[model samples]
Target chain A: MGRIYLGVDGGGTGCRAAFWDTEGRRLGTGLAGPANLTTDFDAGIANVRAAIAAAARDAGLSDDDARGAVCHAGLAGVQSPQTAARAAAALPCTRARVDEDRGIVIAGALGPQGDGTVLAIGTGSFAGRRQDGAVRSVGGWGLRLGDCASGAWLGRAALSATLEAADGMRDPSPLTDALLARMGGTPQGLVAFAATAQPADLGALAPEVMRAAADGDATARGIVAEGAAWMERALAALGHAADDPLCLTGGLGPLYRAALDRDGRRFVPPLGTPLDGALILARAYAEG
Target chain B: MGRIYLGVDGGGTGCRAAFWDTEGRRLGTGLAGPANLTTDFDAGIANVRAAIAAAARDAGLSDDDARGAVCHAGLAGVQSPQTAARAAAALPCTRARVDEDRGIVIAGALGPQGDGTVLAIGTGSFAGRRQDGAVRSVGGWGLRLGDCASGAWLGRAALSATLEAADGMRDPSPLTDALLARMGGTPQGLVAFAATAQPADLGALAPEVMRAAADGDATARGIVAEGAAWMERALAALGHAADDPLCLTGGLGPLYRAALDRDGRRFVPPLGTPLDGALILARAYAEG
Candidate 1:
């Protein structure tokens, strides 16, 4: 009954919270709406608050006790240390820390001090390696400039090919035809959709490309192959060694891992969810 | 002294006006500020009027005469026929016509009825063919959707490569080095610049790539070669024939033409400027 730990896992889609007693026992977990700080800092904070409250209630802790809990968060859109500090300051706990959601994901996948790489590719993509307690990352600059091999990237590539095909520049394929039909059967309609689409909206089309590629659609297959090649190159750039533990995390991570060749790398399962990663960081902070 | 023709060529950078008499004599010409109707309709109209007024003054015509002058316009951002009609209705002339700037460029290059293709590449890009007085076009969908082979496209590609190189996903070269230094000396700097930069702002970097390519920079050479290849495909998609007259127009047009192979292609000089094409259309309308 000395103290409690609250771990927050925040992302573009939603916020989740878990409670753990100081004795290393999991108490309860809660979920709430999106908490992507970069795109919606206010909403992110609000959701994080709601998720924490729910977790505290589920753990049967008093409101005051919940407020006194030690907390650490791995959050999306923590583009700078200042933003992470701002997030920590905005939280309810007396001692709260925040880091990038990707970092937490990597930590959770490979453990606090595990040496390996995490290829996290959901709505966004980033390849991160934790080596000898050192962490480094690649990509994840967002859709305008980077984020290659991400869901948004795949969807955008399909849409681009569809437009080029519609313009008669490329051969029309089943994938392009189906995509154009879904996008209002006109290039202008697709263009209108893309003109104001957020990252999630574009990433939303990933399933269609994936499904089509699985079914052997030529265009979709090409896009996915190109993405796989990009992933290999990015991973290589991060100095991914042949014997390193490769844990593919995030919504699209497993899919990519399956598609990638396995001869040179050692594939491993994630030890825990991102929340567990956040919880591990929380425990580390308390110990320090 | 029967009827005077006013040809207005409006684009993102500025507007120009030219006058011609029934006797086929060149009257005068005028220039004004930016007049891209798509992005700034009111400003476009104002600039068009200013340009027309100056041309009328140069042709020794009064305000009433200028208002009475028959006008035809080839303007940037006229995306649809409805937009074209709206532009004509907003003009001072009782009889006015408006069309996509690329159309008039093609008309000007091929003399309205001359069968040929025009590869117009500037801040924007489009491939158009005039066949037996009928016209068809491809790939003018704008920066987000299309606009391949354009100045903006080239700049964006170079920046993308620079970011990849910075991340160590690809090898760095002199071209990427110089470009990264110019773009605030970092990937984040380039990203921030691109986040809000307009098409012209991005296109402003095209000359750098062109100059670098000329100086044997591998990255710059690759970008230009890619652009040239896109042009060839788009032109071919528009049914460019082996013996068809190919006239390159716009700021980046001739640069691409030079890079492309001349085999199976007939290169020709443009008959006149876009203003001349607008004037030709105006004359045809008055005669009918």
Candidate 2:
């Protein structure tokens, strides 16, 4: 059987799994249903296994070959240490490793040194640092507590700003008109639409905020600037770990790259997807 | 038919209605199911109606007398002006007035002179100032945008502080044990519990945070202090609005009173329940 390594990035939206050789060559890629461990643990693990199996099948590898491979899964909702072990146990692999999904992304971004900062800003915003075989993180306090400068934060801010404009407390901005149109021209409609809204749903409106800013909407611009400011705070919090290369990943990273690239901070893009970081960890354990 | 005025405070937990006479004497009160417009607009309206009908029935007022009297409602999830109008139109009264529940609380606290501030801290937190027939509000941006110092905010902060403690970056506090116990004593259990947890559900732990602070848990104290500081910032944002008596209401108020009062800021308890404010408004309109 051919030797393979598997990596998985389990997020709220979907599960992504990838297979690679020890030499860092990709062999297969797989995608599956949403696998946020917090929401559906068993289902997440199942989707993860199914994704890995599908990837192996796509690579024309037998079950035995896949079984021989080590796997690393980066997952969310593993806030508790006990869940870490359970999450590791849930994956269908002879050898597996698991941690907070952001940690995996940071590992990938920092490579072998793994001693810098990484900001993951998809659904929520979190900055993680790797130091001396230990990791520290900041700012994933969820949607209710913090999540500022996060996608969810940006969207909710945009909506409130729009409402403020509508109420005449502030001047009308293009973002307001656009968001109102999106929410069916009524705050009540917006409230109803938000019943099922997720962090990404709010984050998705980030571009509109950016677009409005580009078009000279002072309020929208200010919101984007505020998001950048928050990212700055997250990175600064990671300063406790060490001062090294800071990597930026996720959908909003590119949007705020220029702002991040300020203050002599080195914001490098990740060398590998989060899943690859998982694979690297698994292979490290297997070889040891 | 005897004239009877009605006031309603419709929120996430349920609707509270109070009926009073033109002489400012409370006649009856009633309660019903959750009526937060953000969650269930129709149900919210229904709950208000149910509470009012019960209050009227208990007051021995005929439908004709109830219809003749003025009604005032303070509601949540009624942000946009158009939505406010729609919500106002839905209530079962001949003359009805509607505003954000927080607004009425502020109005009740400040009255006609309109020089004070009020903090509405429950599942959410917001501050408002009454100034010459105008209201200036700060925060209360919901779980997504702002809501710092609120029950939801405290609970979320408690979790983050707990996680930081668990990770050894911060000191252990009462919140850690309380949160762990709440999460079923296992990490996986915590994640599972939080996966389905509502913001209000997390808010239930806010009182424990207060208790911990009172017991001199540094972490809990720090969290409460932060909430106070946020409230201060919110109050400051009101600028001229904070020139008079500042009122603190909601579940967290009494607990944090000493800490907040230390600023020498004139603090006042809400004049009455929010429904009383509604009733006050109703009586004013009735007399006019």
Candidate 3:
């Protein structure tokens, strides 16, 4: 049988897998629950396998065919060399490689030979640049320490502003009212919600803030503006040059596109998704 | 036996109980684990009982004597009327009253009849003012939404700054180096630490930041200045008058006292501890 390659992108919220033939023709894709290896290594491995199996099935491949495929997995929380090595060795595939998820974004947004910056704004945020096959990153310190322009950060900012309005530290506005209503109509309710919320749970509220901003709520608009400003700062810190190709990727990326000042910067469409980048690596490994 | 009164000061970190007789003579004091009602109602009730039992034992009181004692509990996370009612009903006293922890701070810092503001800066931070038997407050929304000048806030700010320095977003300073060393000398180690850290756990790092600030670390100094500014804002929002008696209370209170601009504000020492305030209330209930 011809060689089949599997690409996996695993993150805090979920995992995705894509299958492609040796000629780079897409076969199918599948998704599963959170696969952050540091949080649950066994669960991450399980989900990665589940996604790959589903993708293979979707592509009309038998179980044996799926097991024979070479895989490349780009995973979050693979920071340490030990974790990367362990993850690679534990994969279900006969031949596989593990890399940091950030690398996939760089390869996806800017191709392997491409050089520039990718501002990934999602449930979490990260900024990265690639030059001469080397990648450097800033931010993505998780939702607590950083992730400045991320959906999680935006939601957290909105919640703080809403509570501030409730406390009269800031003026009450439509945004605060909407947020309070959504959170059961009281500042105390918001407190209860925040007490147990995970980063993604908090990030789920980003849409509410975005909606309010779209409707011209001052507080919401201010939050979006602040987030955009932070993004600009992150881009600058990542050494993004004016003429260098820049791609904004991830769920919140499109929302922030208009807010960001793109003057003198070459805003380019991403060459491919992280999954596609993972497939590129898988293909290379299978050929080798 | 003379009437015995118990004052309980319960919070997120720990619980304190002070026993006194009707004549205002202190008998003994005891401490127990965290007793934030909403977070862990059963644990809070148990801790409160344990603290009172310990105090009673220390004062050479029998179980019956402890059961007959009037108790006043000032507890954190007693937000809603239902929680207050439930907490009051669950206490191990013949007669009892439940009040927000913030109220106890006001009474402790400014006496029952005194009218002014109290800036309680501990693992958390709160600002409250009492006037004509009514109390108004600003901030103290917990580590997530508010608590701007709190130890948790300070620690979190320091951590973020440390990460920023590590990422080259900010200049490396002694403060960042110290923080990294404490967390295992790596950014990834800090990330792991933060992933599992509770609010009190983060608050424990505040002293490190304070120490660095005292040693002239620019990042640490900036964090302290920012925290102090937040305190000033919180006090003002609590309707603090120019000449109002302003008292800083809590573990970190004295440390922040020197940093806060007390211009035109009447700075005063707290008349007693929260347990003292609780005892006063218990005494009133027992006598009445």
Which candidate number maximizes DockQ? 3
Question: What C-alpha RMSD separates each model from the true structure?
Answer: 2.8, 4.8, 2.6
What lDDT, from 0 to 1, does candidate 1 have?
0.85
- After TM-score superposition, the amount by which residue A8's alpha carbon in candidate 3 deviates from its true location, in angstroms, is 1.8
- TM per model? 0.90, 0.77, 0.92
Model 1 over residues A1-288: C-alpha lDDT tens digits? Answer: 778999999988889998898886889888999997877898899999999989988999888888777898998878678999999999989899998887778878888786898888888888989888888888887788788878998888889899999989998988899889988898877787888888788888998888888888888889889888888887899999988888887788787765786777788988988898888889888888
In the predicted model 1, the residue pairs found to clash are none
Candidate 3 vs. true structure, TM-score: 0.92
Please provide, for model 2 over B127-148, each residue's C-alpha lDDT reduced to its tens digit, 9 standing for 90 to 100: 7877666677866656644567
Q: In CAPRI terms, where does candidate 1 land?
A: medium
* Model 2 segments more than 4 A misplaced: A21-24, A75-104, A112-117, A127-150, A153-195, A207-245, A253-269, B75-117, B131-141, B168-194, B208-243, B254-269
lDDT of candidate 3 over B31-109, digit per residue (tens): 8998988888899889988888888888888878877889889998888888888888887777888877887777778
Lowest summed-lDDT stretch of 10 residues in model 3 chain A? A279-288
- Which of the numbered candidates is closest to the native, going by highest TM-score? 3
In order, the Cα lDDT scores of the candidates are: 0.85, 0.74, 0.84
lDDT of 3 by residue, A19-105 (tens): 888788878888998888888899998998888878887888887777778988999888888888899888767788898798787
Better of 2 and 3 by lDDT: 3
DockQ scores for all predicted structures: 0.65, 0.22, 0.66
What's the C-alpha lDDT at position A229 in model 1?
A: 89
Look at candidate 1 and tell me the lDDT of residue A118.
86
lDDT of 1 at B242: 84
> By the TM-score metric, which is better: model 1 or model 2?
1
In angstroms, the error of model 3 at B56 is 3.3
